[model samples]
Target: MAETQRFHDRVALQLDDDGVAQLRLSRPDKMNAIDAGMFAGLVAAAEALQAMRGLHAVVLHGEGRAFCAGLDMASFGRMSEGGGVANGLNDLLERTHGLANQPQQVAWAWRELQVPVIAAVHGVAFGGGLQIALGADVRYLAADARMSVMEMHWGLVPDMAGIPLMRELLRSDVARELVFSARIVDAEEACRIGLGTRLCADPLAEALALARGVAGRNPDAVRGAKRLLNQAADGDAASLLMAESVEQAKLIGSANQREAVLAVMEKRAARFQD
Candidate 1:
């Protein structure tokens, strides 16, 4: 059996027996905006996911009209007052999750997860919201979705793991343009610029289908593939080749690998154990 957990009423997490996990941003009333509570919820949810057994794939999405509208206005107001916000800003500088602070961990945690993570984005994903989606291995956007690197509009820069994540997905020039102009990009342009992996009529549905397909594969092989792909983003050619060999060596004659081969030969589905 699977259970759903709520974090400060801002994030919801549910795991199915098939090893597919669904993580939803739940603050719909505020367009799922990131506030102090939302930040805490996101980190808590990511930490919980890290310990989940048999986890294979994850789908990240938002409830309500927009995926996320960046930071909450109240938080900005606090910054203007120069009191409450100062403490929060200082806290972001402290390392809480190995190379990332608490806020950065909200996004980087997905990148650190061993299994595949798919982001299903719709409505608008601005600033922090956009950064969160970029952290995922794949992004599925609805045709009508709107996204932007909007920190410039607020006289701020993206600091929540956005820079490193964008480097992995976009060309240097393209990233600079979007970041400089703070322009809103439609789904088609987002796909063309590499911000989105695919565009769909229903992003959540398509993302779930993709996640389920990934979950049905041999878990060890799937994890190895994700690890290799992640390494390819930053590793040298020789190192990547060595990593490929190492991963393949672990998978080639394993029981799950053998089951995969036999199932294909028998024209049946493979029953893989965790």
Candidate 2:
């Protein structure tokens, strides 16, 4: 088991013996609302995870009633104050983490992580909160969970890496409608619209179970698959085909891959090395 760490008092990290890391937004008092501290904490947590060895999968969730309540009201208030909006927008425009700025990095960092990331969402995931969840490889939503493309309601846009992520998940028209209306969608609708992988009574439990399953696989193969899938989102057909060949070549004779084969032939569980 990896020791639990706290990031800026806003996020918590715990890695289990299965090599599944659980990242929780930990400001339950504020419903895990994103603030300056929360934003920094998220980035810090992702950066820390990126450096972790033996990591297999990640489960992201909240410690509060909601996954996240979007930007904190105080942040909105600051935006409305003198020169705040311009300064904020200027800061956001600066490239801090590859193609993403600081705010966008808070979400994009998870996508950039080599391992699979799963979000277990419940209660409300509004605006930036929903965008953060969208950053994950898969989202498991609670039956009663509510989500929205809610930036319009705040006189802002979903700039926290939401645009690119949503484009990948939803139809163009559907995405536009959600952005324009800023309407809250239920879990069923979210699943239909591609925002959710599935609906579960206990999303965190399901996410953990899925993470454990992934962790049980050959880590090299699992990470290779994630790399190929992430590339497929933007890579051309030829590049994707080549990528498959490259990843397969790397895994075919790997010790862990051989162990996987042996385990199946012997009717026992695979003991894969990280």
What TM-scores do the predictions have? Answer: 0.82, 0.83
Give lDDT tens digits, candidate 2, residues 119-163.
999999998899899999999999889999987654455777777
Clashes of 1: 0
In model 2, where is the ten-residue run with the lowest total lDDT? Answer: 237-246
User: Among these predicted structures, which one has the highest lDDT?
Assistant: 2
By TM-score, who's the top model here?
Answer: 2
Q: For residues 179-237, what per-residue lDDT tens digits would candidate 1 score against the true structure?
A: 88999999999999999998888999998899999998999999899888878774342
Candidate 1's C-alpha runs over 4 A off are: 84-89, 234-274
